[model samples]
Target: MKSNTPLIGILTSSKSDGSIAGNGPLFIALQKKLISLNGISFVFIPEGMEVDCINGYSYSPEENCWKKKSFPFPDLVYNRIPFRTKEQEETSQLLFSRLREKNIPFFNPCFIDKYELYQLLKTDNTLRDHLPETILVKEKNQLLAFLKRFGGIYLKPTQSSKGKGIIRVRMEGPSEILLEGINKQEIYPSFTQFWEEWNEELLKKRYAGQEEIESAEYEGKRFDFRILAHAHYDNYTLTGVGIRHSQEQEITTHIPSGGKLLPYHLFQSSEHDEFFQTIISIIGKSLSEQFGFFGEFTIDAGVSKSGRYYIYEVNSKPMSFDEVDIEERKIENLCRLFLQLINAYPQEKNA
Candidate 1:
């Protein structure tokens, strides 16, 4: 049933039984956009399926829903695996290897490792100052030393998203420390006691210690910026910047962590805009050079009252933004990338 339409394969997660696990809405939106562009899109789980075909879901325009179907290998594959652990699985790696073996074009192929990306970006002189002071939190003394230097710091899981597993640590006094998590706060008499409870948690997953950005307040609330960018015609373009405001002392300004979204126009500093644009462009190109092709990425950044900006994170698989305009532009830009890739790697009858 495959025809001449450009076929796009979205690589996402699935349950053990091969049912799609997440990103239902995003898949649908992407399908609709591709349809509008005279293309076809389908969601496929890379769980060691048939070598020549994959079991996936495709939109049924007549039924207004997605229907499970067997599809030929797509012209282009867009990696959207939801979790880092899943992306690191042996099966996923095998699938990626197969794609490369067949000479298929894949963009944003995997989730970017946080500490690894930090190490890469810090090597660039232009981006070094814009990054926060960060280190792998492996020992109690290292944490204590960082706290002493910054007075306040944040501990973040290297692979998590949506502000999960983020912690804020501040020196309550010489004898005590204040620890803030997404939903709980506790005061420990000393770093020794805190490490006793947190060391095991850190051992459970990789975590990074970063200096807290004393960001400028909007309406007495802390805020940060999400600068969304995409690769278009071999160059990175800033799609838009979003502002998220913290809710009642929240450790992170992520919407899922109870942060409120603010209009981007509220903070109109031309200097800030230019800074984000220049830095994001640098980051996009750097990532492209370091790691193969990347179609999209979002930079989580904060601005201090002193006008200093810091990049907290860069995510390869960014979540859907709440802003309607950002969503529309993202879809449009993504469709364009798909078209470019489709032309670049024309589909082979057997591949």
Candidate 2:
């Protein structure tokens, strides 16, 4: 039996390649799932993208690209815009304003901000304990002041990802400061000298000072959990959890930084499995409620030696899920999220 299935648009930063597979493999799996479920799918870019002024494109399954078949604007938008500054671009912002004017429902209402998230969640009694001491470094003095208190801290670019621009710092003595391994562990005689040369340049860019969190280690390397969580409106669930072990020289669990990914089930030493899921579910739900209408996220959480979990970071525009069998399940969950969103759109618009 034929039915009027609602269309879904998978959006990202990749430009049109005149082929169907424009948005990458994650969406390919998602597109298949949507089509199998009797829903239409098309991938598009926001740059130079005309939502055709209330128009859309068709998914050419053979070519794996949207190509140029005319349709209506999608019933829901799965925004996968990856760059931190993409939303800040005039054209991108214009696109968002247009989407709003069109009254289209989209996931991830706002871009992810590391410091902004901490400030918002700090008041939550359930999550505050898991957060490390984090503050924005608007002035050279502010970062240095934080250092004096913490003894050692990490300076991170607020808008950066993939463990880039992570500077490890500590004071050698009252007048001396040590910067760990940017080039080499260099020592400065005074904080002012350190500020003029290093801190001054860093201050020009937005950074946050966080107390160095001592995460749980396995086999002599520090490790953390990359828990995959999904939300359908207000309902949330912990879908997947993987452990990322940091490299010996650095303190990040990012896969791009030479960190290794391991299945959570394979880790014999992890805290009670239920404990990890409980923490991730609570954190995930808080984020979904704070920001409305989203499907998935990667909550980067650390475990202390005592098996207590701490949430270090969250990725809204997460890297594609790579675990075995998890990808298909994510697409299934995503379709459910879209179905609920599509069903509720009219009521939301009327109300």
Candidate 3:
């Protein structure tokens, strides 16, 4: 049967040294499966350098660049633009806007649009409840209030990812607080100390702007859930659930902070089994209907000592697969979702 499956163009950042980012081993398995499917072709578009022309026109330049005027307009775009500086974000938004105007189907249609996410949350009470006590604060006063209320809070840039610009503030007592970077080991005894040290470090090396942190503690060990979800055609699937447990004195469960990933089932003690299951089901349903999320995305969630689960952040674009065999089920689920998407759009041609 003749098909019209669109060519899927994946746009993602290249390695700092300009090499093509290899699909991780887990994704390679899925890629192999996708290639054998009836309709669907994935083409990688590596990040390219933007150069200013002599006439003030900036263009993306490559060694063997095809003129933009002659290149094929992609029918489907799998956007994986990693977080960048504010200026880079603006440029990326402009590029994405152009693609949207051209009517290209995007995996995450507009993740960069924070207003859309906010709007979705506002309308859905269930989803909103599951999220952390998040507030968009423009001033330090609002941040201070949040910190006071949460005791120890996490501050993160609304659009940042991969644990960048994530700061953890621990309330030691009434007047004392400890602050640490999401990835770094050093700790500051107070906010003032953190600011001075952070600023000094920033002067020595560039970092993203400050972020509003979310704070929560669990067990004697602080941890967070990395739940992988996907939307395929009209169905939403929870592909995997893993908990990242902080190692040593780290404040975050981010892998860069020496955290280890454990299966979600580990939380299923005889006492909390039903409770855990209920929360997972509730979260899955709420996010699927609210976000219209398609393809793989991840959410970081934390549970307090009192058993209250709070979602820290949601990554609209999640990491491809990981090394552990435990990820096999997730890979399979993702592959199935990809196949389902292809089946739904069977008329489109593979690239």
Candidate 4:
């Protein structure tokens, strides 16, 4: 290992022309930060690479540009392959196996399965209370039973992100049902009618049924919280909390789904801050115990009308927060983590 200037690799998908795909700005930002810290950074795809050396784009500090170059296998890797299908490909799997065999540490290797994540957290007694009632919905009976129990439920594709493939159902009356999706809503006379019309969409993907969280609202619209955490050694550090509010009647508070980002201070409280930290610590411990090492992640939670919080999901590959301070801290923590991993930090600092 190059203790003074370790090589860091950012693994992401590539375009057909062999250019990087997704998170372009983030890759550049990471590279620039690494250079400022006197380390080397490269972005690489997982296919058609030699065992000892990789062909990718490396940042040149002197030229202030990314140049096509060949780099030896990096001391540490940061996986940023955005799509689940791409990450599941044979080539990507081979690359992961090679990294493991070589003892090259990486984080967020793959997306989390929604159902599995819920089940894992449900077993943690400390976290169980914050979780909404969730179940795997493979049959109509399962869906119907849950709807009867909760009166309203959310059907989410187990392997999706960014508010995609989510269907919200509300039981307005004993025989009346309301179905909502991204920017779309419908009224059905009965559950049977809705099922007959929507079963195909539900069956098309593996979905999980979760009891709807009655979220705290601002001016008749719902808002939720996103907590970003970075795992420092075995402990997770709370980098920032970002609040996103949904547009009127929207099914989700995800920013891309017609939701607006709000400053955390607009609704922040010391009690909520402490509550979020406790959840972060418990989650960090639970996930690390089950999934080995995780360097960064985000917890999505909703504050109910009664001021109680419910955890909606834990995202392994957290999206970049647009808040300036949060983004800066994210990059700083990431760079420091790389330094820590390669033993590049001073002995006193590490201690």
lDDT of 4 by residue, 210-303 (tens): 9988888898889889999987876788999999988754688887777899999988899889988888888887777787667888989988
Instruction: Put down candidate 2 lDDT per residue, 267-316, tens digits, no spaces.
Output: 74535466656665676667777876556777777777776677788887
Model 3 alpha-carbon drift over 4 Å, by segment = 1-7, 15-17, 22-27, 46-75, 84-104, 110-122, 171-174, 182-219, 269-293, 321-326, 342-351
**Order of candidates by lDDT, top first?**
1, 4, 2, 3
Displacement of the residue 12 alpha carbon in candidate 3, Å: 2.2
Give lDDT per model, in order. Answer: 0.86, 0.71, 0.52, 0.84
Candidate 4, backbone clash total: 0
Give lDDT: candidate 1, residue 264.
94
lDDT of 3: 0.52
Against the true structure, whose lDDT is highest? 1
lDDT at residue 186 of model 1 (Cα atoms): 97
TM-score of each: 0.95, 0.86, 0.68, 0.93
Model 1 / residue 349 / CA error / Å: 5.6
> How well does candidate 2 match the true structure in TM-score terms?
0.86
What is the alpha-carbon lDDT for the whole of candidate 2? 0.71
Output the better candidate (3/4) by lDDT.
Answer: 4
